[model samples]
Target chain A: MDKNYNIDEIENFLNQEMSAEDLSSFKERLAQEDGLQEEVDFHATIVEGIKQSAELDFRALVQDTRKAMLQEENTAAKVVDLNQNSKSRVRSLGSSRIVAIAASLALLLVAAWWVFLSPMSPERAFASNFTTPKDVLSAEVASRLEETGFANNQAALQQLQEAMLTYQNDNFEQAQQQLDAFQAQYPNNEFAAQAAYYEALSAINTSDYETAQVKLLDLVDTPNFALQSDAKWYLALNSLHIGNIELAKTLLDSLQSDSKHGTAAQGLLRRLR
Target chain B: METSTIVEQLRTGNQQAIRSLYQISFPECASFIKKNNGTNNDAEDCFQEALVVLYRKVSDSNFQLTSNIKTFLYGITRNLWLNELRKRSKSGLKLVMDEQSDREYILTADDQVEQKQEEEVKHKLIAQAIQRMQGNCKDVLINFYFKKMSLREIAAKMGFTEQYAKKRRYKCMESLKQKVRTEYATLGL
Candidate 1:
């Protein structure tokens, strides 16, 4: 701002390029001299001008990259599409661990999500195709069912209890119709919840263990409705039976923590050990 | 990492390298692009071209280091932006400036020569001011002002009362101002 002021020194001082003593001396000089003020204002203006010129245009980059990727994909399509036929004949299965288990089980390779993966509902799976672990009931409970002869309504509940009993006897497919009727009638009940497990076992028998495992988890962990501890063990056992070592180990470990299931599950874990 | 690493990786067509370089450059570039009446689109093109130029120059290996990476990037970006302005003008896409709105821009060589010194000083002052803040004050200010976090998000994430966060931010800003004024009094507006 001062025509006669040395712009360089004031620029250095104001921008703090000046050393401490020099900055102090410059500040003293500024307090006494109006020339330094003008020079600093001028220098700051120059810095602002240069700073204002700096910018980047990334949208243009993305547009260019997209064009390049599209071209690359076009070239790649000819090569990649040729191999599509072979994939149908033999699932590439990729590098995931789930594929390792599925391959051992000869699971249905189609992309249709016949298997649910969420851990929340494991029972609807079991009652659909497999045996419910009647072994989980205490002796008194088992005797009570035998005495009652499972003859409540003799309709949905009776059929469900019968199917559950037959499943306990390992008559998995024989229990299917009864379980289905029971599931439909008492959808919210524990018996209906266990229907999914039988469905799962049926799928597994057909080598569709992927779908079965999902249902097994629900049946195994029914909370205090009389099946939680049993469900976890069964889920773990099936996970192992199907060669899902990781899941099997996790469930088995959890079962080991519950004193009731711990004795039996620990035995299984020891065998695994 | 060094900007040259970005230059090298970009030359090899690494998309992540391209991403990182652009992300790091975004704040500085945004302010500059906004000032020039250029949309974010223009800034991106200029940035890519700057990256391309740097990538091309990186093979020399003997390129003298004259300035901090940000300053070097700023310089290159400045050059490319000026070129973009010229090209856009020729195509008549540029707006003609009104005499009153066209603020006089003056450049002095003195600042350019001493930019590194200025940066070192400013950076230290900023660090000092940031350090002067309390944990909660710093957290609010850094998240809201520097990191551009939303107020609602900051409150939820930090589990702070929203009113308390607001108070902290104001007090923090005032503290920063006081600190900057105390330590570097001659930072003329």
Candidate 2:
């Protein structure tokens, strides 16, 4: 076995960037190099996580785009297109934009604009797409993201994005480590809330509902949060997932009566029933 | 319902045909902007660009399809939509909060030079495998498949008797078949 089967080599293999000759050689060496394959699988998980996230992101983007096109036409015809956008049963705003909206919303709550959006704005209708497009989460990551200010810091943001891909690929330990690192590095950074939120989501994806709930519960009141509403939404959804109808109803109640979420939330609420 | 057919109908001011084509391909092509990591609004904007591509392709006689009409339209749409997505992803990420998923599909076959490059990759892969043969075997195969040369003419050109040419031709075809199978298998096709 070629003992030189290093981390870089394994990462390259995971990426499918290896030359054909290198692939042939790597295959030849695989029979006896047990550790190498293990390392390769670890990296592969991270790579696949990124891809899965990308796919969800793309699908979400497409759904939102379809709605957006329709909305654009509506925007051309109507004074308050929000009402019409609310009518959409499915749609998603881009993640960063959603986070900004959430943050701005928090800012508005404390400061000047309490409600920047028109009740009829299509944004309300499309909000469900954001969570659907988001990866399954552990409550820990979910709650971490609930702290609105977490999504703003660049370092925290990079670590969280990297962790998201890692978690999706089932590199739980690495993901946890990354999350821990992110929390340690920028606990109050803008991306921190989202990062923490995803940390919880990563746990949820693994079916650790109790842990996920704990993580979410931890972040429920964390101030300066970007995804508090989303965390609440996920908590409510998680209750349904765990077969706790009463708890689910309670969590759902905490969210603005779907009408506040606009038509999309109302539609999702209808579906939940 | 196709841009090509619609273009034909459009030339005669057939409003229904034009609308049918636009209605079918426009939103899909437009929506791809989001599917490949763009905002919903960006996808809407992508429709006009996709229409422009259809307009150009429909006018070009060489743009005949060997595939389904929608697939062709989608191919073009996916290409054009992705191009805009890339441009926006780089510049608009700041204003945009969360990035959309699926960024690995940079440029697909519908995008101008990228389309040509993909075809060239296909040609090169198959052609290189064919190059594995030598001398008469290679020459006979190329003459038959690539040049579309007649057996009698090839025999004369290669200074071979017709009988000898025929025998060589039989062997050459077997070799070609094997090569094609290996090449295609490598591609998992």
Candidate 3:
């Protein structure tokens, strides 16, 4: 596609350096000629690839800035810790005048640093408000396992139990595996829906937010899904985690009117706003 | 800062601009990818790709700010993450290598794999061609074309006369064209 236009023409067109007449003609050609439009699109895509790489380079610069800021904060925190520990050691030995003055100065410095540096970021708010929802199967489902036809779903329920236990034991990897197996075996059954919800939680625990979002979104659409409220809550948290503050706010707004999650949703909405 | 101002700052390579944009966009996109079994690094990569897409659109000569920047950014980020997920799934390539599978996974290179491999080769060749550019030629070309620097700005930055910068830029472009032709022919791209 790029072969159709010379580099200079491409550059001129991209930069809007072409004459007004030339620009008009070019736009007309782009509109009328499929081949020309395709060429431009192809060139644009390549340019986009290069630009994306360039943006990463720029992002690296920002990351360096953030890293430096964090390092400074850490160093300051360490100094405060060291000073506090020294103050304690000195107090245990003797309440010397010199140690007293040093401790006061150290405390003053720590206060000053805290005052200067502790502005709350949206990310911090998200981290503070977000809690992983529990993945336990319902007692009703567990009791129903003894009935006929429900016996057929017992293996899936057992798998769910194992998955929940593994999750509680912090064996998230195994929990994810068990959930996956349960879902596959019990597809189209209620156990599968439960497994999918747990699967999303397992994914979140593992920081696999994409898979978790997918599963959660699907669950939200399911008819009379038991975990729908929990799914919506976590989905909102997922939005917050990924820095979509507006989306998080919107979701929380919707949930503020929800009977079950309304209180938690209202609390989060205040923080977000 | 205003969105337009932030966009302008980004065009000029401002680190603070990137930081502001990152704070807004990274969390949601990162979470999306993470939920999809992507690592933080994978999320970072996808977010960067999405930013680039947005940057290109924003920096276009005829571009207009029709949508809210955040909405536009989120849309692109979602699409990019989804596309990346699809690609990873199709290829069965984990963004983060699975050590357990790594030991057992021997790639059975089919036509699709071969084609992908060849495309990668061609990409590298194109990159090499750009890399092989000499001195100010590379700098001038990158500044003018990629960085969208004006000839005068390039001249000032390169400490060369504007005429010399213009001439060198054309020469550098010609050299790139020649290199592309040669390399593509040699590599059968």
Q: CA lDDT of each candidate?
A: 0.53, 0.53, 0.66
- Give the per-residue lDDT digits (tens) of candidate 2, residues A1-273: 224336546656765889999988997777676666754653343333322222332234334333423432332233234334653533354346787799888766744432333332222322333353345444454576566775454445556667778876777657766876787787766556666677767666665554455556556556767577677667656545534344444445445454444344444444444
RMSD of each: 24.4, 24.6, 22.0
Considering every candidate listed, which one attains the maximal DockQ?
3
Residue B66's lDDT within candidate 1 is 48
Give the number of the best model, judged by TM-score: 3
**Where in model 2 is the C-alpha error above 4 Å?**
A1-132, A135-158, A167-177, A184-186, A256-273, B1-189
Per-residue lDDT tens digits for candidate 1, residues A1-273, read: 214555447556755788889888888988898666755654454333222212112223444443333332342343244345645545654556787788756545422222433332223322332343343322433455566565653455555556667666666566555565666777875455556656555444544444455555545534454555555566565555444454565666656667666876655554454
Angstrom error of the Cα, residue A215, model 3: value is: 42
What lDDT, from 0 to 1, does candidate 3 have? 0.66
Interface RMSD per candidate: 13.8, 20.4, 7.3
For every model in order, the fraction of real contacts preserved is 0.00, 0.00, 0.16
Pick the lDDT winner: 3
**How do the predictions measure up, each by TM-score?**
0.26, 0.25, 0.42
**DockQ of candidate 1 (2 decimals):** 0.03
CAPRI docking class of candidate 2: incorrect
Model 3: residues >4 Å from true position, as ranges? A1-273, B35-38, B58-72, B89-121, B149-162, B185-188
